[model samples]
Target: MHPDRYHVTLVLAGRPALHGWWGSEPIARAQFTGLVGRYGQPGTRITLVDEETGATLTEWPETS
Candidate 1:
């Protein structure tokens, strides 16, 4: 992870990895990882829909 660049990466337990571009802060990444870790092995999926355009942005899968 680069301190100067902003990115979000989600490691799924039994699924593929997901990466996103956002504010690349260590704290941000850590927080996200922590949140996901609390849930258990990442196999859960989430669909992020754009309310205005009704478009899907990204789908996240839980990881172990």
Candidate 2:
């Protein structure tokens, strides 16, 4: 994987449903959307955070 790529994961019930790396910020949204589209369902909530900064970026509903 490239150095800039980041692996984002969706954990459901303490288990991971999806995991992949995003190359850049622009792709983060699309990558997140795709992962959510595949694994997100009713009552599905996601927590987005930065591993390096230990900051909580965004946390909300994962489904449309």
Query: What's the TM for model 2?
Result: 0.56
lDDT per prediction? 0.46, 0.60
Residue 62 of model 1, lDDT score:
31
Q: What is the lDDT of candidate 2?
A: 0.60
User: What ranges in model 2 sit over 4 Å off?
Assistant: 42-45, 62-64
Candidate 1 lands at a TM-score of 0.30
Q: Which ten residues in a row have the lowest lDDT in candidate 1?
A: 45-54
lDDT of 2 by residue, 1-64 (tens): 3543444667777676666555565576677677677767765556555555556555547225
Clashing pairs in 1: 6-24, 12-63, 13-63, 13-64, 41-63, 41-64, 42-62, 42-63, 42-64, 43-62
Best by lDDT: 2
